[model samples]
Target: MKIIVDAMGGDKAPEEVVKGALNASNNPEIEIILVGDEKKIRPYLKDSDKNIEIVNAQEVITYDEQPVNAIRKKKDSSIVKGLKMLKDKKAQAMVSAGSTGALMAGGLLILGRLEGIDRPAIATLCPTAKGPILMLDIGANSEVKPKNLVQFAVMGSIYSKEILNKYNPTVGLLNIGTEEEKGNSVVKTAYSELKQISSVNFKGNIEARNIFDGDFDVVVCDGFTGNIFLKTVEGFGMYIFHQLKNEIKKSPRYLAGAALLKPAIEKIRSSMDYSEYGGAMFLGIDGVLVKCHGSSDSKAIENGINVAYNSVISSINEKLREGLKSVTEKGE
Candidate 1:
C-alpha cells in the first residue's frame, strides 16, 4: 500500500515529517510518497530506504490562510497535491499535520464523500479507563441533523470494530445528562433514532465526565460540542501535569516522592499524549484522510502513517459501506 505524507504541513515541517515517513517505510510492503519542496525533502531521504520517494509541492497551506481559498489558489500546495494523489489512486491514504480547516475543506472538495454519507465526521481515538474510545464529529460539521448523528454513529461503530478491533462496540450519544430527553432537539431526535438501529449497540446518553470512564466505545455529538470537549480535555490534562511539576519542585521531599512515582506518571502522560493516538480519521470520506496534530513530532507522524496503513489493509471504507447499508436497511 502507498500512503502520501504532507512533509511541509506541520510546525517542524520536512525534518520531522520526513523522519516519520522514513520510520513508517520500514515495512517493505508500504511505500511512502512525501509531498513537499523537493530540495528540503531530498536531504532527509539520504538515510531512508527504497520504500521512500518524493513529490515536489512548491506551495503550502498555512493555518492563517482561508481553507477553501488556499486550496483553490495553491494548486501546487502540499495538502492539495497529497490529497490528489489519494484521489487519483496513486496512494491509498493521505496524512497531514497541517491546518485542520484546510485539510477538511480539501478533503470535501477534492476527495468527495462516500456514496451514502451526508457528511464526513472527524473520528479520534481517545484514551479511556476501559481503553481507547472512538469519538466522532470532533470538529467537522458544526451544525448537524439527527440523521447526521445517526450516520456518525454508524461510521464510528464500523471503524471501532474494523480498525480498533472492538467487538460489538457500545455507541452513545453525548449529552448534558444520561436521560433520553436530556439534550437539545438534535440529540434528542438522534437518541430516538439510534435506539432503533439494530446494527449499532446504542447506549443511552453519555455525559462529558463519563467520556474517559470508558463505559462507551463510540460517542456521537455535533462538531461544535465535540470540538469543545476534545480541546477542554487536552488543555485540562496539560494543566494538571504543569501543576504537578510545580508542586514537585516546592521541596526535596515532594521531589523524592515524584521520582518514586515517575513510572506511573509517565504511563498516565503517555496515555493522554495526542501523539500516541496518531491522527484523527475523516470518516465517511471516499478516500482515507488522516489529520495529525499541528505540532506533531516525528513519532506522532509515524503513528499517523501506521494508522493510514491499517485503514487501507483492513478495508475500512468497504466495511463502512457495508455497515452503513446494514444500518440504513434496519432503520427503514
Candidate 2:
C-alpha cells in the first residue's frame, strides 16, 4: 500500500514529517510518498530506506491563511498534492499535520464525500479508562441537522467495529443531560431516529462527566460542541500533569517520592498522551484521511501512517458504505 504524507503541514514541518515517514518505511509491505519541497525533504532522507518516495510541492498553506482561499490558490502546496494523489488513486490514503480547516476543505472539494454521505465528519479517538472512544464532528461541520447527527452515529459505529476492533460498539449522543428530552429539538429528533436504526447500538445520551468512565464506545455530537469538548479535555489533561510535576519539584521530599512513582506516572502519561494514537480519522470521506496534531512529532507521524495503511487494507470505506446503506434501507 502506498500512503502519502504531507511533509509541510505541522509546526515542525519537513524535519519531523520526514523522520516519521522514513521510520514508517521500515514496513516492507508499505511504501511512503513524502510530499513537500524536494530540497528540504531530500537531505533528511539520507538515512531513510528505499521504500520512501518524494514528490515536490513548492507552496504551503499556513494556519493563518483562509482555508478555502489557500486551497484554491496553492495548487502546488503539499496538502493539495497529497490529497490529489489520493483522489487520483495514486495513493491509498493521505496523512497531514497541517491546518485542520484546509485539510477538511481539500477532502470535501477534492476527494468528495461518499455517495450516500451527506457530509463528512471528523472522528477522533480519545483514550478513556475503558479504552479509546470514538467521537465525531470534532471540528468538521459546527452546525448540523438531525439527519447529520444520525449519519454521524452510523459512520462512527462502522469506524469502531472495523478500525477499533470493537464488536457491537454502543453509540451515545453527547448532551447536557442523559434524559431523552433534555437536548434541543435537533438532538431529541436524532435520538428518536437513532433508536429506530437496528444497525446502530444507540445508547440514549452521554453526559460530559461520564465520558471518561468508559460507558460508551461511540459518542456523537455537533462539531461546535464536540470541538469544545475535545479541546477542554486535552487542555485539562495537560494542565493537571504540568501542575503535578511542578508541585512534586517544589519539595525534595516529594521529588524523591516521585522518582519511586516514576513508572506509574509514566503509564498515566502514556495513556493520556495523544501522540501515541497518531491522528484523528476523517470519516465519511471518499478516501482515508488521518489528521495529525499540528505539533506532531516523529512518533505521531509514524502512528498516523500505520492507521492509514491499516484502514486501506481493511477496506474501511467498503464497510462504511455497506453500513450506511444498511441503515438507510432499514430506516426507509
Candidate 3:
C-alpha cells in the first residue's frame, strides 16, 4: 500500500513532517510519497530510498488562507498535490497536517465522496472510559440536518465495530439532556430516526460531561458542536496539566510527592493526547483522506500514517459504503 503525505502542512513544516514519514516508512510493505518543496525536504528527509520519495510542489496553503480559494489558485500547493496523488491512483491514501477546511474541501471536490453519502464527516478516535470511542463530525458539517446525524451514527457504529472491534457498538447523540424529548428540533428528530435502526445500538442522547463517562462507544454530533466538544476537552486537559504544575510549585513537600506521581501524571496526559490517535479522516469519501493536527509533530504524523494505512488495509471505505447502503435500504 502507498500513502501520500503533505510534507509542509504543519507548523514545523517539512522538518517534523518529513521525519514522521521516515519514521513510519519502517513498515516495508507501505510506501510513502512526500509532497512538498524537494529542496527544503531533502535536507530534513533521511537517506533517499525506494520506500520514501519526494514529489516536489511549489506552494503551500497557510492556516488562514481560504480553503476553496487556495485549492483553486495554488495548483502546485502541497495540499492539492498530495490530494492529486490519491486522485491519480498513485497512492492508496493521503495524509496531511494542514488546514482542516482545505482537506475537507479537497476531499469532496477533488477526491470525491463515496456513493450514497451526502456530507462527509470527520471521524475522531477518542480514549473514553471504557476504551477507544469513535466520534463523528468533529469539524466537518456544522449545520447538520437530522439525516446527517443519523448518517454519522451509522458510519461511526460500523467503523467502531470494524476497526475497534466493538460488536454492536452503542450509539448516542450528543445533546444537552438525556431524555428523548429534552433537545432541540434536530436532536428530537434525530433521536426518533436513530431509534428506527434495529442494527444500531441507539442508547439515547449523550451529554458532554457523560462523554468521558463511558456509557456509549460512539458519540454523534454535527461538526460545529462536535468541534466545540473536541476543543473543549483539549483545553480542559491542558488546563489541568498547567494547574498541577502550579500546585507542585507551591511547596517542597508537595513537590516531592508530585515527583513520585510525575510518571503516572504524564501517562494520563499522553493518554489524553490527540496526536496518539492520528488524523481525523473525512469518512464517506470515495478515497481515504486523513487530516492531522496543524501543530502535529513527527510522532503525531506517524500515527496519522498508520491510521490511513489501517483504513486501506481494513477496507474502511468499502465497509462505510455497504453501511450507508443498508441504512438507505431501511429508509431510516
In order of appearance, the predictions have TM-scores of: 0.97, 0.97, 0.97
- Give a tens-digit lDDT track for model 3, residues 1-332: 89999998999878999888988999998898999999998997556455998899989998898989988999899989888889999999999999998888888889898877889999998777776688999998979889888888888998888877888999999999999998889989999989998778999999889888777999999999999998988998999899989988999999999989989988888989988988887898889888899899999999999999988989998998888888788776
Per-residue lDDT for 322 in model 3? 89
Model 3: lowest-lDDT 10 consecutive positions:
44-53
Least accurate 10 contiguous residues by lDDT in model 1: 323-332
Q: Give each prediction's root-mean-square deviation over alpha carbons.
A: 1.2, 1.1, 1.1
The alpha-carbon deviation from the true structure for residue 24 of candidate 1, after best TM-score superposition, in angstroms, is 0.6
lDDT of 2 by residue, 65-93 (tens): 99999999999999999999999999899
lDDT of 1 by residue, 104-197 (tens): 9999999998877899999998899998999999998999999999999989999999998999999999999999999799999999988888
Count the clashes in each prediction.
0, 0, 0
Model 2 segments beyond 4 Å from truth?
none
- Alpha-carbon shift of residue 251 in model 1 (angstroms): 0.7
| Index of the highest-lDDT prediction | 1
Q: Which ten residues in a row have the lowest lDDT in candidate 2?
A: 323-332
